[model samples]
Target: MDFALVGLIASLILLMVLALKGMDLLIAAPICALVVALSNGLPIFATQEQGDIANYSDSYLGGFSQFLKVWFLVFLTGALYGKLMEYSGGAKSIAHWIIEHVGMKRAVTAVVLATGILTYGGVSAFIAAFAVYPLAASLFKQADLPHRFIPAALALGSVTFTMTSAGSMEIQNWLPAPYLGTTPYAAWQVSLFTALAMAAIGIYWLNRMIHTAYQQGERFILPQASIIASVEAEQQQNVNPLTAVLSLLAVFITAFLFHQDYSNNALVIALVAGCVVLVVGYWRQLSQHFTKVGSEGALGALIAGANTSAVVGFGSVVKATPAFAFAVDAVTAIPGSPLVSAAIAVTVIAGITGSASGGQTIALPILGPIYLDAGANPEHLHRTISLSSGVLDSLPHNGYVVTLIRAICGESHQSAYLALAKMTMVVPGICTVLALYFLA
Candidate 1:
């Protein structure tokens, strides 16, 4: 038992360390699984049962394959939908329209809201960040706000209020359904309130940060020559805004209408329908690179699916360990409402994993059944779990944060991450507590 505990700790630390260092999760996951298997006294590849238990291959591969079987289509369709939107200029068009109407005075709000629109419309968060950055840069420059705050604005918009909110097309919103037997719209009333509160608080805090920075004599500086040239080239394209609006609306309408009937697969159908709409509505706009776009979408889906599946595989091995059982038992035994307990457990695991969706995928397989058995409301559990996952998963080591801060915006963590923490982690954490109070 002591050895199992040590192994669990070692595996978690190794996983987080490697993931934060930017190692491919596909490589890191299997190695972590090996750590757990060795500590648990499990055979690595024997099909024969040890006593009544299955071998490591069965548990690890079982989790990996199960997630793929149930969710490959959703991942494929979501990624493809995002790619099609990117290729059709729909995403950029939407961002530009929002910025145009919002104007420069409210530049931060404009960027945040624009990102929210694209994210809820099924564009990947990474893609949304890329699509919105140029416009955000321009808007910040016009407003004289510091450029460093751009990541916070983007993270707040894309990952916080919109990503896990009810009716979100993001995978985080869809992942709980299979485990809870609920729709992506589960606990929507509570979800709506929580999302609004998060937005309100986050925006207020974000503006305060910008105001403080402005008072400190910090202001927007011109981007690199290469970045400006790239942004200029992108803006030179001719794309209609109406077509973009309609394409996004197609996704929302289809998903909203069909979600109840199809469950998790509803997202698949909606994404497919949205893709058809984009192709038909923007055929002339998309014709030049349609084949390349499709291929890229497929490749992107593979990468996204593989990353998520690898974590699920790691989770499978962990759950089979005695230490995992002990931890779950300890968590479930916590006094107070089960909702609070669920929130804490999910948040901690998410912090450990550094991926919101990955954390939920892992915690739910074990936590879901236990919470349901304790008579916890599945809707409440689902919503709380979803929101909680977003809270700590935005830690500096989080995949999305790293991507936004370094890769996308080209800013150091030291300069930009505090504001991000306020919007994504601090606000969301408070919202989670409020949600537990109201919904539980």
Candidate 2:
């Protein structure tokens, strides 16, 4: 193996190891990127770089700044909107309604379905996690389910089927379109089948794990320093469940109507609209909390966005390495069916980058034309890579996985990642394989 390849693999391993050990990404990402740069013979500064060789400053900061610029507002307003729902008691109201109608025993399913509804409706998964987690915490506590499973349930709904299914507005699903000359709804029949299978299998796996934990006497255990206030000086004002749902509808409906022309900007608008509805619907409760909500929400937004951006910077450095190019070449050259090769290629790259969309963006441009020239079906290639991108992308170091486990759930990776892996990685891997076989 090339020395650069050795550095790339070692740096990824070190990154994940540090992440599992609870090192902050803002620090760890730069440290790991330095390793990649040193080993790959890239210059530390742009002024020192030779032709076509990316320097650490240019590549790392470029990815970091680019992600933040694109996503920070969405994070800001989404967190603020979620905070409004939490502070106003709207999320709790929805939880109570679900308990009454859906029954407490089905709390896990409720979390999954609620998140799926939001994600499929064009809500950012980060936003969906924020919006649904307060409700999930309430439902899990009421049902006595272990809080550790919360991350998995949220990920299962947000990242698995809903993310990669045909027509999903998620970047992973739609990313292959321009390169493959296919629509977002490419290979609808296979995509739908794979999606449903993934959902059913993942839900079953999650519930089974929760049930087994319950049998072993494990139960809901809220953290001592929980982000949610266990008690408040001002009693939570009662919010009507139906009326509270209007806020969610605002986000979904607005994103649905304006997505084509506005794209991600529509999500920012949708989240702001949701916040507007929440403020109006629960003004009596939220009016006094407004200053606190905005400050806290903005802080949360910075933390989440910065954490994910740190990893994106790491991926950016990895992308610049000769090893990444070599890996892409090696994967695309795999013998046999283009569909299988494409699926494997995307999955491996996604794992390496710890991002589905990142992997697809890198791989499709190279793989698309190769397979197309070999007479591959564009729609099949589109759907296959769509599903494939979601598979290995959930490895422990993934930005979403790290954010979901540590930042959002307040659970350490040690406690939360196993269930997450079973749901997001294993179930999605199985479903993708099934799609490949059927499509083959």
Candidate 3:
């Protein structure tokens, strides 16, 4: 009935059509943005200034610019580091190590756990998935784990939850950049306790799915269970282990350097640092896998990063909602209880976006201000909201889950909803209980 409600509904309908019809986002997003703009009585081409090659973006262009201004460098830096890891066999090495060391049965669990740790350290989810997925799939098959669990582990490990918690080196949390007009550093922080609690929720959810599969007799097949043994049978590569070790350390070193406050541009640091390691340790080996490694790395980035970029763009679009002011107004209306306001605000924004990053885009900008005005620790508020985005966006049907299901197991949308239910409702419930405890 209401105009704002209609625009919102239309936007949602577009997302559904895109999903069901296999429409491209480049087409879907602009079309949807136009609809929202027109429905809200805003001109689609308000940029007719001076008639000089007029630009055609809603006010969202301004928001998008701001989003990019803050995040582009971070993303590029992340991408570069990710690219280097791929070049050095670092990513494959990590994946292989997890499978061989953890074994098939426990590998799924280990990979998921590793993702959480890396995510909490501020790596991008795109990088995490790329780094882990190839190996995780083989691990899944051997453990009799469902192939679908590959994406599940990667997404859960990377995207939602403590992975985005404030103070995490992970880019997802910081993608919101300036929340409520405050710099990212202003958000309070993600406590170790909160992170542990969030991680517990994730582990429990995965285990529950495992039990369900056990009951269902779901088929499990590990395609590369013998990869490591076979490779070793041919003799370890002449490339020294030290080379691989340092290449892997690139990520760890970068995370350590930025641990004090996550302001540094990770891409530049990772690249320069990774390059040095690759040169000194196994520079020659680079040629051995040149074309193959280069392509695989980019493929990883493209697959994971493409979806991420869209969600990033969507955040830009929604931030321009005519009702954005109204949304901010509503968040400000919460009286007396700051904690309740934070919980509700984070949940709504995160749920709507199907992206923890997008939720921060909407919620942090508005709610961050409210909390600051109320004298809440800016960092704390930021961190809590960031953490909130992860839990809220864990819906089974979200892009992350969808990608996981399709990539690993050929699951149709219907089959993956069970994991979504477990994570969205069950995991968040546990996290919420703990959140209240922490706040009190």
Candidate 4:
């Protein structure tokens, strides 16, 4: 790759490091993007390069706007949906039902699995963690489980929610072509498979950790209320169980219809149906929740999307021009069997976006075409790649991880890293290895 392309790669790494170091994502992303822009000599668009340097600022602004458009509706609707659920007693009601059925012994596991399932319903982990943590914290405390387990449980829950949630309208999942183009229907099937794999692995790991903690009586490591207490008190409600379930069912029905014709947006239809259910079930009560959903959801979604918006935009800009094209080619040029190449592509792309969705966006666009060109099974390759993307996305540096850790645990720096590692490293590793074995 050329020096400029190499610099673009280096800048991306630096951006992650900055995020890990507690830099604001908005600042870090733009700075990193600017660095990439300067390094790659990207001046907004291609036409401007041959023209003048005066258009550099315009390019940056234009790129920023493009990212905003992608993140705005996706994150807004998703976030609002969560907020609405919070206000309407939907999430809590679900958690309460789960606890009532599973009993405290299995509460943590139940919460994680349930969150994963709900994510498939277009729920973001940000909303899931907030919605579930209070209920989970109360149950974990009653069970005399370690306090640390609360945040850990929450982190695990978010991973499943964000990674493979059923009808997710997450920009990374729904809108982005790079992520699903190579796989198509693979999103649905693999989404389910990954949820199961992640849950099994997460359960095994959680049990192992708890067992070890109890055996050693490592009281220091267990979750404390202090970790997630603030979030619980300040929590918002959205949709009740009846609404969430009915809404979700409508989504399933719509999805079936969508299968008959691929042009419809599953998320838009699902959320709309869900909102209808909410309104129908509890008119005035639902109206009260709408404001909470609008404000909180918008804020939360904006927070998450801002970091990614700039990063995705800048990354796309860098990838588009000749300056960073060499880096793109170089990654694909790595020598391996097509299968191995596919796997590497999945892992690499996932790591790039620090998100499963993002990975799909970055890698799938490029990787999908390559895999298709190489004549790989579109379903298998796409599923494999999509699932693998979740691995790195669960890492502490990832936007979702940091957002939940900070929001739930109320800790920063290294406090949540342990919980993050439990989900991101141990859990995802187990799942990924199993997938590799199965796919192999």
Compared with the true structure, all predictions reach lDDT values of 0.84, 0.80, 0.57, 0.61
lDDT of 2 by residue, 1-440 (tens): 39999998888888788876768888888899889988998888865336555888788888888778877887788778778877787765664565456666888778888777666745567767766777778778878889999999999999999999986656566668767877667899998999899989988888899999999999998765445655232223367866568987887678667756665666678778888888998999898999999898899889877876777787788778888778777877888888999999888878866778767765776778998897789999999999998999888877778778877788887798989999988999999999989875
| Candidate order, TM-score descending | 1, 4, 2, 3
Number of the predicted model whose TM-score against the real structure is largest: 1
In order, what is each prediction's RMSD in angstroms?
Answer: 2.3, 3.8, 4.9, 4.0
Candidate 3 lands at a TM-score of: 0.79
Q: Give candidate 3's error at residue 169 in angstroms.
A: 2.6
Question: Model 1 scores what on Cα lDDT?
Answer: 0.84
Compared with the true structure, what per-residue lDDT tens digits does model 4 show for residues 1-440?
A: 37676767787688779878778766776677677777766664446346654334555566567667645665666676666666777767776667667887886677775565566666677667776777776666666666566567777766643554334444444433334353134546545666577777777778787777768765433234344444345334444467667765665566546633453245555566666665676566676566666777778878867766655655555555565455557666767545456666656656655656555555656667776787766556655665566666655457766666665655564655675576765676566556555554
Which residue runs does candidate 2 get wrong by more than 4 Å?
Answer: 48-52, 69-77, 121-147, 166-189, 216-237, 263-266, 269-276, 289-302, 361-382, 399-412, 438-440
Residue range 343-385, candidate 1, lDDT tens digits: 9999987876667887898898878998898888888888988
Estimate the overall C-alpha local distance difference test score of candidate 4.
0.61
User: In model 3, which range of ten residues has the least summed lDDT?
Assistant: 226-235
Top model number, lDDT: 1
Report model 4's TM-score to 2 decimal places.
0.83
Q: Quickly count the clashes in candidate 4.
A: 28
